[model samples]
Target: MSPEPLRSIHVVAGVISDARGRILLARRTEGRDLAGRWEFPGGKREAGETEAEALIRELQEELGITAEIGEPIINVPQQYPDKRLRLDVRRVLSWKGNPRGHEGQALAWVAPEKLPRYVMPPADRPVVAALLHPDRYLVTPSPADVDDETWLGALQRALESGVRRLQLRMPGVDAERRRRLARAAVEASQRAGVEVLINSDIGLARELGAGVHLRAAQLPELSVRPLPDAQPVAASCHTGEELRRAEDLGCDFAALGSVRETASHPGGSVLGWEGFARLREAVSLPIYAIGGLQPDHILEARQHGAQGIAAIRGLWAD
Candidate 1:
């Protein structure tokens, strides 16, 4: 039988930053669940407390600083077997006083890219990805039908529009043609300051000084991360098991779903918004809702805990 649904306890957290782009993290005390693990500093909401109120209060008590909470950035709902936690995280845009571990816990101000080096509780994982990347992910559809010039032009235009993260996937091409396309795409992306990943091609990604995006089937066979820590590694995940594997393998982010129908996969089984939320709640990694999402669904997707939306046709057409 399936486990019973966990009752959520609302907790407010803050991603406090300093002038040098460093985020503050605190170690849990001796008596809490997952103690000694590092996490974004904040605490549970008291009776009738608003999110901002609770966040500010928690920061003052725990960090010995007066925090100015910005609008709620993201809400993370996680199941911990014994309990469920809804971590309502916000950006602490500014604050007063030097942040200290008033509760006698350890504290660190870490660079955003170096956050992955520190071990954290499961729930804090996604927040790291969200901090570093606050933009949509673009996936290029098959370029076989379109001419090379036309395809590259469309991709360059999209990159110019601030699509910072991209995955280039072109199937049914000869190995030589694929490499040529990959090289061209990476060149175009670099000029616009975008990070590029190759779909399930480890060697090619390495050769291009790019990243690798693993297909779900690739997760189980790998015992170690495919790329060096300096590079990014992403995965395509569908279920809780896949997500867990992605974490174990040390992926940077995941593109999850068929959250809605799309022309690419006509009449495909769709996860819908609610199904997407259920799957999202199961893991801590940043997820980009795939399947048929457009730019407009970004807010709604984030509302359900996705970091951002990842699209093929949606991004290409736009």
Candidate 2:
């Protein structure tokens, strides 16, 4: 017979942003699990409480403030040694009264960019990514046949369509032409205040002072991260072992999938949402659901514990 399912806790949290663009965080009280680690303020949802209702009540009880909770930002599912945690985060549209430590927890208002510096529980990390990182990661198709002008034009269009993070993936193209395209793409992405990562090319990435996205094969070949902290490093992972290695290599995020059959990988194994979530629980790195995905799937992806959706054809423009 199958073993009993692990007990799960449904917790609600709120992202309280001030006019200065800082987020409010509360330190876990001394005796709590993960004590002293900062997190978005809130608590476990009691039965019969809606996520919004739970968040509102939690804010009032923990911080002595009444919150008008807004839309859901992300729902993160994490597995611990003892139990499972489902963290539902929402936006705090507005609130009344000064936020103080009603429960004796220390309070901090941190800048969005600096949230990484403060240690947090595994479930809270993905919520931070949802708030600061883009919901789409656009991977460029090979530019081997297309002229320079046509390829760059498509890149420009993708940027205008709100692709904040990008991967310059030209797998079959020759090195020289790829470098030429990379130089131009990097220049255009920088002008638009977007971050571009080179796919499987550490030297080029270093030369261009850009980020790198490693292939799964490269995960075990390197002991240290290829780039500095200022330059992001991403990876493509297919299994929990690969995901763990990517995490060990200090990858900022990972792209996992073949979530569905696609033209590129016909009949390849598809993870489906359940498989994706299962692997997601094994690591803490923010992940993007790739393969046969489009912009419309971002909400579904996030619900399944993905950071966002990563796509080539789905995001590519003419």
Candidate 3:
């Protein structure tokens, strides 16, 4: 009889960084598993140790730095041909002390744009993709203002105006109506060479073969993974914790909002440039400054390390 094949179990880890958009990578020590390979600075979670606690401990032990672990950014499960491994990757942004290699291994702070230059584990690919395109927008046609014919025309106009990604968000419409609109939007976007995501209507998005975008409330325990056909799934994020969770869910991009004041979410506090910069340092994803954004704010957002700026009103303005 043939011998039973080996199996692998899931393990949690973190990608540690600082405020300057630099990631900490570790060189595996000589004589250790996967020696000479470079990887994010983290270790396996011990029993009874929370993921945050595990990350804090790993950073201290490996890099001699005291770290304050933030929310998780990306959780990727990968299988190597030689050894099957499921990696639950997190992103840690805050910490103290200049990092030094405590275990006699090499360490470096790499800029996000320079990540591709380094050799990384196969499991880190999705994490890399998230880093490349961090900001996402959810474009919803106003049902009250536009009829079906007008809506399609508006969508076409939006597409021609460089709205590559969109979400068909018609909340009160009936199922059949939503399906019809979603399919139409998908077809129109395809013709215009844009991408369309259906908001919360997974079945319709699947039927129409469109991407999906999750609302902030629906993020904590997402069941349906973004379908393979969609290629990119995005979400709306209001807090650093939520931003981290969205990244963990393998989101292609995310929108962080209320950067300035807006009517949509009245009285919501604006996280000015300082706050945006702080959050930008916490994760490797491409973040967009949402809410009361205008054309002039785009340059400022990019200066703060954001991928770009996203807005419903600003983009639609004449």
Candidate 4:
């Protein structure tokens, strides 16, 4: 039997900032749907209200503050077991009143780096990731397939370009070869404080203290997290179901794409920008829009609720 159609709940939330560069968070009051969970302080949109208007109203009502809503970022679309949600998160440009919890909920203003210490609601997790993580992800063009030094050189260049997160993907290679390259990649990445993931290899990921990226094919086989809770576990997802699976399996993030047609996969059905936004709204994990993308897409990706863009080509072609 098919699941019931999701009832979409549109919400407008705000990331309020202060002069010291800290962001505000609010805890849900008791008896709410996500009671006790921390969130970017704001509320649902009342009918006939614009997103910015709703945000301003929600902030004034909930926190007894008047805020000027700024640019929208990370327009998240997430689904709970019972209902779906569209969390439109905008940055609060400025405010005139002190932000105090008028509804008895607690509010805290903390540095962005400290956001991970707070236990946020599921839908807000990706928003936090977007706030703290790099917008672009580099998936090494199949290490072996790219020829010996081509990939390694590209790896160094990409890291030098300030790509802080990367993945090394190689398949059907000898164990020894895979180990050699993984070690090299890991070593190269750590020198720059880059977080690297080894594709589909739990043993290698653990041995190297790196993360593991599960392919879509690996999703159905996992019953629990494949790595230590502290280690990042990202997944490749092409559908909402796959994104849900990634979230359920305790993935740190997921990449969803091919956002547009690529030379490599000509005529393949593309998600486009709108399609990416729609799929992104369906899940909470930070998602990177992949396939046929470039540096300029970063801002657009964030606007549509993505951590950023992921790519194999052009990412390293400096």
Name the candidate that leads on TM-score.
2
Error at 99, model 4, angstroms:
1.3
Q: List model 4 lDDT by residue over 229-261, tens digit each.
A: 768999999998998899899898999988989
Clashes of each: 0, 0, 2, 1
Q: Give the better candidate number (1 or 3) by TM-score.
A: 1
Give the Cα error of residue 249 in candidate 4, in Å: 1.6
Candidate 2: worst-modelled 10 consecutive residues by lDDT: 74-83
Ranking of all predicted structures according to TM-score, beginning with the best and ending with the worst: 2, 1, 4, 3
> RMSD, each candidate, Å?
2.4, 1.5, 12.7, 2.8
Off by over 4 Å in 1: 1-5, 96-98
Of models 1 and 3, which has the larger lDDT?
Answer: 1
Ranking by lDDT: 2, 4, 1, 3
Q: What is the total number of backbone clashes in candidate 4? A: 1
TM per prediction? 0.90, 0.96, 0.58, 0.88
Please give, for residues 31-113, the per-residue lDDT of candidate 2 as tens digits. Answer: 88899999999999999999988998999999999999998888888998878988888999999999999999899999999
C-alpha lDDT of residue 277 in model 3 = 60
lDDT of 1 at 129: 70
Question: Per-residue lDDT tens digits of candidate 1, residues 1-318?
Answer: 997776778889999888898888999889998998999999999999999999999999998888878876777777787777888889998898989888999999998889988889877877777777854899998888887888888888888777899999998888988899999999888888888999999999999999999999999999999999877899998887898899889898898898988886899888887887788777787888888888998878876778889988778853
Error of 3 at 36 (Å): 7.5
For all candidates in order, the CA lDDT equals: 0.86, 0.92, 0.69, 0.87
